[model samples]
Target: MSKISTAILRGVSGAFIANSGVGKIGMPAEYSAGVQQAAASGIPALAKLPSDKFGTWLGYAETGLGAALLAPFVPSRIAGAGLAAFGGGLLSMYFRNPENTEADGIRPSQEGMSLAKDVFMLAIGLALMTQGDDK
Candidate 1:
Protein backbone atom coordinates (compact mmCIF):
# COMPACT_ATOMS: atom_id res chain seq x y z
CA MET A 1 0.00 0.00 0.00
CA SER A 2 1.10 3.53 -0.72
CA LYS A 3 1.71 5.96 2.12
CA ILE A 4 -1.54 7.82 1.51
CA SER A 5 -3.57 4.65 1.33
CA THR A 6 -1.99 3.37 4.51
CA ALA A 7 -2.74 6.63 6.25
CA ILE A 8 -6.33 6.63 5.00
CA LEU A 9 -6.89 3.07 6.06
CA ARG A 10 -5.37 3.69 9.45
CA GLY A 11 -7.33 6.86 10.02
CA VAL A 12 -10.62 5.42 8.86
CA SER A 13 -10.03 2.22 10.78
CA GLY A 14 -9.11 4.13 13.90
CA ALA A 15 -12.25 6.20 13.69
CA PHE A 16 -14.40 3.15 13.03
CA ILE A 17 -13.02 1.38 16.08
CA ALA A 18 -13.13 4.39 18.35
CA ASN A 19 -16.57 5.63 17.34
CA SER A 20 -18.23 2.24 17.46
CA GLY A 21 -16.42 1.20 20.61
CA VAL A 22 -17.47 4.34 22.43
CA GLY A 23 -21.05 3.94 21.30
CA LYS A 24 -20.99 0.30 22.26
CA ILE A 25 -20.10 1.24 25.84
CA GLY A 26 -21.82 4.60 26.10
CA MET A 27 -25.06 3.70 24.35
CA PRO A 28 -26.71 1.87 27.24
CA ALA A 29 -26.50 4.86 29.49
CA GLU A 30 -27.32 7.39 26.80
CA TYR A 31 -30.13 5.37 25.25
CA SER A 32 -31.66 4.37 28.56
CA ALA A 33 -31.56 7.93 29.75
CA GLY A 34 -33.33 9.10 26.62
CA VAL A 35 -36.03 6.51 26.95
CA GLN A 36 -36.48 7.29 30.59
CA GLN A 37 -36.78 10.96 29.84
CA ALA A 38 -39.11 10.39 26.91
CA ALA A 39 -41.31 7.81 28.58
CA ALA A 40 -43.45 10.64 29.88
CA SER A 41 -44.27 11.51 26.24
CA GLY A 42 -45.57 7.99 25.58
CA ILE A 43 -43.02 6.89 22.96
CA PRO A 44 -43.55 3.22 23.92
CA ALA A 45 -40.99 0.60 24.89
CA LEU A 46 -40.76 -1.13 21.51
CA ALA A 47 -39.60 2.03 19.80
CA LYS A 48 -36.54 2.22 21.97
CA LEU A 49 -35.18 -1.25 21.27
CA PRO A 50 -33.09 -0.25 18.27
CA SER A 51 -31.23 2.34 20.27
CA ASP A 52 -30.97 0.06 23.27
CA LYS A 53 -29.73 -2.93 21.29
CA PHE A 54 -27.41 -0.94 19.07
CA GLY A 55 -24.53 -1.18 21.52
CA THR A 56 -24.09 -4.92 21.34
CA TRP A 57 -24.32 -5.03 17.57
CA LEU A 58 -22.08 -2.02 17.22
CA GLY A 59 -19.46 -3.63 19.41
CA TYR A 60 -19.35 -6.79 17.37
CA ALA A 61 -19.37 -4.98 14.04
CA GLU A 62 -16.66 -2.57 15.14
CA THR A 63 -14.49 -5.35 16.44
CA GLY A 64 -14.85 -7.12 13.14
CA LEU A 65 -13.92 -4.04 11.15
CA GLY A 66 -10.95 -3.34 13.40
CA ALA A 67 -9.73 -6.87 12.98
CA ALA A 68 -10.25 -6.77 9.25
CA LEU A 69 -8.37 -3.52 8.95
CA LEU A 70 -5.48 -4.76 11.04
CA ALA A 71 -5.28 -8.17 9.47
CA PRO A 72 -3.20 -9.00 6.42
CA PHE A 73 -5.65 -11.53 4.96
CA VAL A 74 -9.02 -9.90 5.74
CA PRO A 75 -11.04 -7.74 3.36
CA SER A 76 -10.99 -4.20 4.65
CA ARG A 77 -13.64 -2.65 2.41
CA ILE A 78 -16.25 -5.29 3.06
CA ALA A 79 -15.76 -5.04 6.78
CA GLY A 80 -15.73 -1.27 6.72
CA ALA A 81 -18.91 -1.08 4.66
CA GLY A 82 -20.73 -3.53 6.88
CA LEU A 83 -19.75 -1.59 9.96
CA ALA A 84 -20.73 1.65 8.27
CA ALA A 85 -24.18 0.36 7.35
CA PHE A 86 -24.65 -0.71 10.92
CA GLY A 87 -23.80 2.80 12.00
CA GLY A 88 -26.14 4.33 9.43
CA GLY A 89 -28.99 2.21 10.65
CA LEU A 90 -28.32 3.41 14.16
CA LEU A 91 -28.28 7.02 13.00
CA SER A 92 -31.50 6.68 11.03
CA MET A 93 -33.38 5.87 14.19
CA TYR A 94 -31.43 8.34 16.25
CA PHE A 95 -32.33 11.42 14.24
CA ARG A 96 -35.90 10.29 13.90
CA ASN A 97 -36.55 10.11 17.63
CA PRO A 98 -39.30 12.59 18.45
CA GLU A 99 -37.89 13.29 21.85
CA ASN A 100 -34.46 14.11 20.45
CA THR A 101 -35.00 17.59 19.14
CA GLU A 102 -32.59 20.50 19.07
CA ALA A 103 -34.87 22.79 21.05
CA ASP A 104 -34.85 20.40 23.97
CA GLY A 105 -31.10 20.93 24.49
CA ILE A 106 -27.92 18.92 23.87
CA ARG A 107 -29.40 15.75 25.29
CA PRO A 108 -31.82 15.29 22.40
CA SER A 109 -29.73 16.87 19.67
CA GLN A 110 -26.72 14.80 20.60
CA GLU A 111 -28.63 11.74 19.47
CA GLY A 112 -28.95 13.28 16.04
CA MET A 113 -25.23 13.95 15.96
CA SER A 114 -24.57 10.43 17.12
CA LEU A 115 -26.66 9.06 14.30
CA ALA A 116 -25.00 11.35 11.78
CA LYS A 117 -21.68 9.79 12.65
CA ASP A 118 -23.11 6.51 11.47
CA VAL A 119 -23.70 7.99 8.07
CA PHE A 120 -20.14 9.21 8.05
CA MET A 121 -18.94 5.78 9.02
CA LEU A 122 -20.90 4.28 6.19
CA ALA A 123 -19.08 6.55 3.77
CA ILE A 124 -15.77 5.52 5.22
CA GLY A 125 -16.77 1.92 4.93
CA LEU A 126 -17.63 2.49 1.30
CA ALA A 127 -14.22 3.97 0.79
CA LEU A 128 -12.58 0.98 2.38
CA MET A 129 -14.60 -1.24 0.11
CA THR A 130 -13.42 0.74 -2.87
CA GLN A 131 -9.79 0.69 -1.73
CA GLY A 132 -8.95 -2.67 -0.30
CA ASP A 133 -5.46 -3.78 0.57
CA ASP A 134 -3.16 -2.88 -2.30
CA LYS A 135 -0.77 -5.68 -1.51
Candidate 2:
Protein backbone atom coordinates (compact mmCIF):
# COMPACT_ATOMS: atom_id res chain seq x y z
CA MET A 1 0.00 0.00 0.00
CA SER A 2 1.16 3.53 -0.59
CA LYS A 3 2.00 5.77 2.33
CA ILE A 4 -0.64 8.32 3.34
CA SER A 5 1.73 11.18 2.71
CA THR A 6 2.48 9.97 -0.77
CA ALA A 7 -1.17 9.49 -1.54
CA ILE A 8 -2.01 12.96 -0.38
CA LEU A 9 0.74 14.52 -2.43
CA ARG A 10 -0.22 12.66 -5.55
CA GLY A 11 -3.92 13.23 -5.13
CA VAL A 12 -3.75 16.96 -4.56
CA SER A 13 -1.18 17.78 -7.17
CA GLY A 14 -2.68 15.43 -9.71
CA ALA A 15 -6.14 16.89 -9.38
CA PHE A 16 -4.90 20.44 -9.59
CA ILE A 17 -2.73 19.79 -12.62
CA ALA A 18 -5.42 17.79 -14.38
CA ASN A 19 -7.98 20.49 -13.84
CA SER A 20 -5.64 23.13 -15.13
CA GLY A 21 -4.99 20.99 -18.17
CA VAL A 22 -8.70 20.58 -18.88
CA GLY A 23 -9.11 24.34 -18.74
CA LYS A 24 -6.27 24.87 -21.17
CA ILE A 25 -7.67 22.31 -23.57
CA GLY A 26 -10.61 24.57 -24.21
CA MET A 27 -8.82 27.89 -23.81
CA PRO A 28 -9.81 30.75 -26.12
CA ALA A 29 -7.58 31.58 -29.02
CA GLU A 30 -6.37 34.89 -27.59
CA TYR A 31 -5.51 33.26 -24.28
CA SER A 32 -3.76 30.40 -26.00
CA ALA A 33 -1.77 32.81 -28.10
CA GLY A 34 -0.76 34.80 -25.06
CA VAL A 35 0.35 31.74 -23.13
CA GLN A 36 2.15 30.35 -26.15
CA GLN A 37 4.00 33.61 -26.60
CA ALA A 38 5.12 33.58 -22.99
CA ALA A 39 6.34 30.01 -23.24
CA ALA A 40 8.09 30.75 -26.51
CA SER A 41 10.05 33.45 -24.76
CA GLY A 42 11.63 30.75 -22.63
CA ILE A 43 11.96 28.01 -25.25
CA PRO A 44 12.31 29.41 -28.72
CA ALA A 45 11.27 26.14 -30.32
CA LEU A 46 7.80 26.58 -28.91
CA ALA A 47 7.39 29.56 -31.21
CA LYS A 48 7.44 27.29 -34.23
CA LEU A 49 4.10 25.74 -33.35
CA PRO A 50 0.81 27.50 -33.82
CA SER A 51 -0.68 28.75 -30.55
CA ASP A 52 -3.70 26.41 -30.70
CA LYS A 53 -1.58 23.36 -31.25
CA PHE A 54 0.76 24.27 -28.44
CA GLY A 55 -2.11 24.71 -26.02
CA THR A 56 -3.74 21.41 -26.93
CA TRP A 57 -0.50 19.49 -26.74
CA LEU A 58 0.40 21.06 -23.42
CA GLY A 59 -3.05 20.21 -22.08
CA TYR A 60 -2.73 16.58 -23.09
CA ALA A 61 0.72 16.34 -21.59
CA GLU A 62 -0.46 17.76 -18.31
CA THR A 63 -3.50 15.50 -18.22
CA GLY A 64 -1.43 12.40 -18.89
CA LEU A 65 1.08 13.34 -16.25
CA GLY A 66 -1.66 13.94 -13.72
CA ALA A 67 -3.25 10.61 -14.51
CA ALA A 68 0.07 8.89 -14.04
CA LEU A 69 0.55 10.48 -10.66
CA LEU A 70 -2.96 9.59 -9.55
CA ALA A 71 -2.79 5.97 -10.63
CA PRO A 72 -1.83 3.70 -7.76
CA PHE A 73 -0.71 1.06 -10.21
CA VAL A 74 1.94 3.41 -11.53
CA PRO A 75 5.28 3.48 -9.78
CA SER A 76 6.12 6.59 -7.83
CA ARG A 77 9.49 6.94 -9.47
CA ILE A 78 7.92 7.03 -12.91
CA ALA A 79 5.28 9.54 -11.93
CA GLY A 80 7.90 11.62 -10.17
CA ALA A 81 9.99 11.70 -13.30
CA GLY A 82 7.11 13.25 -15.23
CA LEU A 83 6.39 15.74 -12.47
CA ALA A 84 10.04 16.66 -12.27
CA ALA A 85 10.25 17.27 -16.00
CA PHE A 86 7.14 19.44 -15.90
CA GLY A 87 8.47 21.42 -12.96
CA GLY A 88 11.81 21.84 -14.67
CA GLY A 89 10.08 23.21 -17.74
CA LEU A 90 8.13 25.72 -15.66
CA LEU A 91 11.29 26.78 -13.85
CA SER A 92 13.10 27.22 -17.10
CA MET A 93 10.39 29.60 -18.23
CA TYR A 94 10.68 31.49 -14.98
CA PHE A 95 14.46 31.76 -15.12
CA ARG A 96 14.93 32.52 -18.79
CA ASN A 97 12.89 35.72 -18.77
CA PRO A 98 14.72 38.76 -17.43
CA GLU A 99 11.40 40.42 -16.65
CA ASN A 100 10.50 37.53 -14.39
CA THR A 101 13.48 37.98 -12.07
CA GLU A 102 14.60 40.77 -9.81
CA ALA A 103 17.95 42.53 -10.16
CA ASP A 104 19.61 39.68 -8.23
CA GLY A 105 18.32 37.31 -10.94
CA ILE A 106 17.56 34.51 -8.48
CA ARG A 107 14.73 36.27 -6.74
CA PRO A 108 11.31 36.43 -8.39
CA SER A 109 9.92 39.68 -9.63
CA GLN A 110 6.21 40.33 -9.13
CA GLU A 111 5.54 38.78 -12.50
CA GLY A 112 7.50 35.66 -11.61
CA MET A 113 5.98 34.88 -8.24
CA SER A 114 3.53 32.33 -9.66
CA LEU A 115 6.24 30.60 -11.65
CA ALA A 116 8.62 30.56 -8.70
CA LYS A 117 6.02 28.67 -6.69
CA ASP A 118 6.40 25.78 -9.14
CA VAL A 119 9.64 24.93 -7.34
CA PHE A 120 7.51 23.10 -4.80
CA MET A 121 6.39 20.69 -7.49
CA LEU A 122 10.01 20.01 -8.33
CA ALA A 123 10.79 19.37 -4.68
CA ILE A 124 7.80 17.08 -4.24
CA GLY A 125 8.73 15.16 -7.37
CA LEU A 126 12.29 14.63 -6.15
CA ALA A 127 11.00 13.48 -2.81
CA LEU A 128 8.67 10.94 -4.40
CA MET A 129 11.39 9.67 -6.69
CA THR A 130 13.90 9.07 -3.89
CA GLN A 131 11.52 7.58 -1.37
CA GLY A 132 11.40 3.81 -1.07
CA ASP A 133 8.11 1.94 -1.09
CA ASP A 134 6.49 1.84 2.34
CA LYS A 135 6.20 -1.94 2.34
Error of 2 at 122 (Å): 0.7
Where in model 2 is the C-alpha error above 4 Å?
Answer: none
| Per-residue alpha-carbon lDDT of candidate 2 for residues 1-135, written as tens digits (9 for 90 to 100) | 359989988888888888888778877778888889988877889888888677877888899989989999988888988898889889999999988899999999999999999998998888788889734
- TM-score between candidate 1 and the true structure: 0.52
The predictions' CA RMSDs to the true structure, in order, are 6.5, 1.7
Give per-residue CA lDDT, model 1, range 42-63, as digits (tens): 3344355565654565566566
